[model samples]
Target: MLRQSSRFVVNRASAALVGRGRRFSTDLPAETGGDSKFVDDWKKVIPNLEPPKTPSAYMKPRPQTPSTIPSKLTVNLVLPYDSALSAKEVDMVIVPASTGQMGVLPGHVATIAELKPGVLSVHEGNDVTKYFLSGGFAFVHANSITDIVAIEATPLDQIDIASVQKGLTEFQQKLNSASTDLEKAQAQIGVDVHSALNAALTG
Candidate 1:
């Protein structure tokens, strides 16, 4: 009975030892089939990873500036049966056409027109002057050259006041001495012509 009791106690002790050994072996690398130490080392070395890339320079667009205005103008003046007058490019050139008065400026479109009896005012830098035209035609070109072909163009300073007055008196006398309707009408036209000439001279 004592020997049997001892044998049973020994067997129980052996079984407990074997179970502890199996639990310890299951935690080994070959039993777990993975390296826990290596995984831990990798976590310590790189907690989180990101892809690598090169940095670039930043650029911005620039603003634009405005342009400026022009200063000078050059043009030619031509007349029929007279010397052409050379002038600087100016603001305006007024002409008396048969239809009416015409005003021209730089960059004006090309045109051809007839002129009447009136004053032509030319405006330049700080100066304005007038020329009297009896009848004419004007041709404007791209370069602002105005060719004025005139039947008559008289400068105010060059007109003779005495001659105009004398002509007026003669035409008045002819109107007063007319003996027929036809003669009266002819004399009346002469009077009108002389009167207009006198007014132009005086003006």
Candidate 2:
């Protein structure tokens, strides 16, 4: 009886030690560095099976950093249905960010700015082209590349003053008469957009 009890205790201690080792191993993260450590382990277990490809494997390698910044800033402006500008080199661009108007030039720091309803201006020499953008985003890359994407964009000169004023007045009335929360929100958006449009044209 004594021998049996001692043997049972020894078995339980061995099982507890195995369970503790497994728990510690799972808690530790795999040291993958750059390459996959699991890839080697899988190959040992299943020699014929191929390892899955990682995201880095499919992505293009980034270009090496240049010693000096380029003179011109490459700008790509696109709309939903069209590419407004592509690979165009310019001296500067002024974007209407949510924070405020932001001027970007060559060697500008990498940034992503949320655009608001306002005017976007592209500068080349003394000539400047302006456009009214409804809303979008601007991406500034470290390699002197700037991308502007907008839902709706129109040339500043093309907007009709009479139409904008009419829309603003109509939306203002709707906002005042709005009963539901959704109606109020929609009317508010219209008013804000039209107001921005009027301000862009006049200012």
Candidate 3:
């Protein structure tokens, strides 16, 4: 009987020890699996850090800074009382040249033309502004600058045609009556100016 009781107690203690060992073994695998999974997840999110790569010959070159050189006509038109027109990047300027009616453009050849009494036309894009200049000197520079020094500049619409015609008739009468060379020459100049002005207004 004593031997049987001792055998039963030993069996219970062995079963308890086996159950504790199984729990330890199962918990160890779960804990280890969770830790390994956490490490793998962190590794996936983290990025490898390195310095940025420089351009190679295979890559296209980046755009460089544009040159500071001017590429348009710079006109400085001035009158005695005020600055008439100071235009940069003007498309074209037309004036009555002593040689003929002339148009000044960007990068034109260097020339100095004496302006006469006519409509001075300044063109920019699609808009044109006309100014009746009595007389002026246009200096064209090779560096794309045009300087217009006008004695008098008035808007084309301001001058009345009737007044110009009356002046023309008076100048013509003065030219016919003049007995001296200087008087005839001066009167002729007046007639020519009035005729040009009339032409400008009508044309």
Candidate 4:
């Protein structure tokens, strides 16, 4: 009886789905998307040894060529759902690093920085675009490529100040009324982010 009842329910549900013309495969998750991971496995860590002397032309320190290509800083800024920036040449990037605010330019040191919730200023020549990021990681490569994977990024103008204020107030209340340590911490984080957004907008 139990087996038959279960089979009948499953059959009815499947029939309803089929009748509605909705075919779904259980193999894949409903909202699957591409990852924004930066892989650097192709980078060579070993230094190449200098070759033997090749007399006058090859061995001699070559004169600087006027036609030489200039080095450019390529910035790839990505969000969870899609890429915000891709291999774009930028003059400077001001990141809100966990340690402190840091500026990156061409030939900047190859290092990783943990970003915080703040504005990321990207400069291209005279124009500067500021993006408010929630949090993420910034990986600077030796070849003048910086990859930024942010949890959430948006411009201050797109974010409604009223909504941020409401969230901040609610989180503050949650923090105050929280009885457990974990709840208070979570609420505190919300309050902090909302506070940061408010500051970014007001300032």
**Model 3 ranges off by over 4 Å:** 1-71
User: What is the TM-score (0 to 1) of candidate 2?
Assistant: 0.72
lDDT of each: 0.58, 0.80, 0.72, 0.73
Itemize residue pairs with steric clashes in candidate 2.
Answer: none
Ranking by TM-score: 2, 4, 3, 1
- Per-model TM-score versus the true fold: 0.49, 0.72, 0.63, 0.65
**Residue range with the least summed lDDT across 10 consecutive positions in model 1:** 54-63
Better of 1 and 3 by TM-score: 3
Index of the highest-lDDT prediction: 2
lDDT by residue (1-203, candidate 3, tens digit) is 45554454465447747845422111223222423433343344433422122223123322221244355678888998898877556888998888888998776766789988888898889988899888889987655677899998888888999999999999999999999999999999999999999999887
Best by TM-score: 2
The TM-score that candidate 1 achieves is 0.49
Q: Which runs in model 2 stand beyond 4 Å of their true positions? A: 1-65
RMSD of each: 43.9, 13.4, 36.9, 20.4
Clashes of 2: 0
Off by over 4 Å in 1: 1-81, 172-196, 201-203
